[model samples]
Target: MRLLHSKTLEFATFYGDATPPYTILSHTWGDEEVTFEDMRFIQKRKSLPEDLRRSPEFMLAFDAAARLLFPPNRDPEKLAGYEKIRKTAEIANRRGHRYFWIDTCCIDKSSSSELQEAINSMYSWYKKSAICIVYLEDVDISFPAGTWELAPGHLTRFAASLKSSRWITRGWTLQELIAPGRLTFYNKDWEPMISKYVAAAAISSATKIPPYVLATGQLHRASVAQKMSWAAKRETTRTEDMAYCLLGLFQVHMPMLYGEGQHAFLRLQHEILQNSDDNTIFAWEPLSSPMLPSIYRGLLARSPEAFSSTSKHQVERSYFTTEAKEGIRVDLEKAPLVLPSGEVYYVAILGSANGTKLSFGDIHHLKQFYMFLKQLDEPNNGRRKQYVRVMGIPNNAQHQVQHNILIFHAETICVRQQPIIPLNFETTEFSRFVLRPDTYSATGLPDIQAMTVWPLGLISEKKEIMIPSHSKDFTALVWLQEHFNSSVSNVQVLLKFTRFPRVGYWCDIITGKQWPKDRDSVDEWRKAIERNHSVKELAQRKRYRIGTRSEIRTVSIEPGIHADQICLFVNIDGLII
Candidate 1:
């Protein structure tokens, strides 16, 4: 470790227990800040080139050094880094500390190993310091402390300015704020502002960091998500440093990879998962972009912002288990079903809070289902009756037999309104609905509302049955098929039969002309529609030829039944025939 001599204005190296107590400067990096090279030149008594000495950063370092090294010859110019270092040394000297460390000049950043070591040890260094001097360059204060305190409405403005300081938003300063045992804030003119105790609440409200963690440095007491939320809005100059700066807060370390870009954060998440089994790490919601299908989205979160909501709640670690022996086990007798585009997914039975079972085949599908449930759960004039269940699956062979499964429950969404008929055939659960040939002209489209329906059920490895139903239910199912035409052919669709005011019958669209021949052949044809078919191909398929001779024209698929027939069926009372 490197420490700057408060009295001598010279740099000294210390290792292990030989290091003396030092005050550390915490401030945002400025473009003109001094560097280790500048300090070395100053220590060697070498004359800096005219241009170099004229630089704002070099001048600041020189002036600060002059103030401490020769007390009577301090410069009076208002410069960025000069006052911060000068006041910090003055405060440390008053407190009887002979050394202080400023990030810009203390360590040689040109050396990779030294830089890495410094970063990894920064938290401990700050924690063991005599005091952490926070320089809020953006905050302004009146010269006389008593007069400033006595000014009308100054305290409120001061608090607001302190809370909104650029010092708090820098990536490296996050650990500096949390890891220190004692900290004092100083305004631009080096006027004493407030202690960590006096400004705890305001800091907490501004940063979304808990007051307890700031006061006691008990970061381990907070869940991974809550800790991550502290750095959500914070930023670093280099993208990768966004993750590196957070190393101490998570108490996990990995080799620094500066050029890896955003993947650095992904690696951080990988390292975090290894040390802790908190599943809340996966509970982050994606920003802006449409949610990726579950299978395609990796375990890592894009940014700390994902945990913003989780941080607000008092998270309990007891909700997740680190021990494999305590994890919930899911068994899959078959390999994951493969889509035509080569993506693999599986179906898992999830138990709902109401004791009913629902099956979600893919993570993306589950997320979609949950989104609908959330909409239904939104509060209106009255409280909405809502139920939700989320269970985490350990990413291990023992907990996941053949496939990964995450189960959630919503009573208002998936509950069966009518008693299921006890049928003797195989049935599948589905949640998606689509409409095909999405456009139509009133003049050319048919008014044929009535249509024949064939309800096919997949039973065993070879047999299928055509279910017989009442004309009304059958017609309703056929009518429902038109509304689902836009859906991907491979998506299992749920069709609801309405009898005026009541939902009379509900069925799942199991298979059509392209249905797999058997269980063993399911994967060969279970390709996702968007993946297997191009936009042009889908568009071509949606068009219809109006006439043969001179009037041949392309039009959207006519409403009702076109050349492509519709098939639908429901399992009578969850029974398989």
Candidate 2:
């Protein structure tokens, strides 16, 4: 089987490198090679042709046709397991079960037009799927395992570049990164399998409507939280109704990536969608199987109201991890078990003290954290609770008031309220997000995506300058100069300056020129600074260096000069006098 190569496709596959074990299969059913387009058509059975419609014999033929597209390989555990499930599913289908859709087999690879059609509808298929099977064949865990492993250096690095790197796109969502690329194909699988592709298409299509508008529409149509509340109030028991209720959530609340139990939940949703109503919600309770955590079930049983929406409380409860992480100096011992759905939240069993000051910002942040925890709460008789609470801290009885410092127990703290957290950032750590030149510009002004790329620099002249990405920009420069020095903090940016190369060597922002020579030492950097700054002694005291750039030059800035005041000299002449 031959693989088609394109700049974006190749880049995606390359980045995917040993990061994950991706299967390379030809789109061939038996002897005929299937094109990607065919895979799309097959994947979107909802849009299948007359011939493609259901027939036990046709299904068998289609499955056989899919086999040829796969690359030859000894059965790896995941593939082998998938194949086993496929066979069983096919058997069920033959017996007149509605249908079983597996992306690898259902998608036709022979047609791009068809694939394009299906690609746009991926979200619906996921949201509506009976089950979404997430197969994690491999994991690239180059990062250290322990939370304390996150040191000052790590935090600095995070603070400096966390806002502007492709790292977020590295793990499960690489499909979104390097998007409009083949990795996007994997995106189809990222959705809830029980869903169809219609809503996804409408939201992502090139129509004049804004993307967020479409997203908002999807959110509106699938108001999972509203319905869940209704279901709870009505005391619905039909599994199908409950599943539909869950679908709204799977699409909106759950992380938009493949996860354990996500697929099973989708399947349960589909079954419930087909068979039950509010009264039958509990009928499928027995069928819940082991898709999501039992804790969710416990929560559902206790206070069905909790699963309504993803809010501050629910987020904390759902994503919170109890593992004490470094830099997070909260005493779990003083905290109580928080159930976000109900009012059961961690109160500072102790209040605040003036002498022992705690940042109100921390308290606010903790409030949001408590919100997440509230959502994770399930209704249970007072006998036992599914969650854990901290106990037995000696009350600072000596102090007038105790500070009830708080944090969320979920996955990562920063992601929960990025806008606020980015500003309150007093830590030695940085947050990074990477921005593509084309994507940055396409996003239009004040590119938040660009700002996420820390120690920011531009990929092109057209794109607006952002704080983290354009680290050389006056503001970014000052921030770097003042804060960029640390084991954790490092700045390496790629600039796509519009103009051509200059005669000498150095990264100059004014001319958009890149010099041929490299500045290797701190002394060399000092010389460069001396040329730029009149105060030679100041230049000596303030260290600078050549930071790496992609297509253009990246210069190191020292503390004191407000980044806003410092201008990138297109040529030496452009340097501010």
lDDT of each: 0.53, 0.27
Find the number of clashing residue pairs for candidate 2: 119
Give candidate 1 regions above 4 Å deviation: 46-79, 142-155, 289-296, 313-577
Q: Which 10 consecutive positions of candidate 2 have the poorest summed lDDT?
A: 415-424
**Each model's backbone clash number:** 16, 119
lDDT of 1 by residue, 1-577 (tens): 8898887777789999999999888988885566776566556543567787678998877667766754354222233555556677788898889999998878798899999898888888998898999888888864355564345565566668966788877889999999898987788777777777666776787888889887988876787778888888888999999999888888888888799998888778767867875555655655543321111123346678666666743333322222122122211111233322222333322222222233333444332112211111333464332212211211232223333333333222221111121222111111111133213333333222112222323122222222222222221122112212333212233234322332233333332333333333323433432233323212211222222313222212111111111122322211111
Q: Give the range where candidate 1 is weakest over 10 consecutive residues by summed lDDT.
A: 557-566
lDDT of 2 at 516: 24
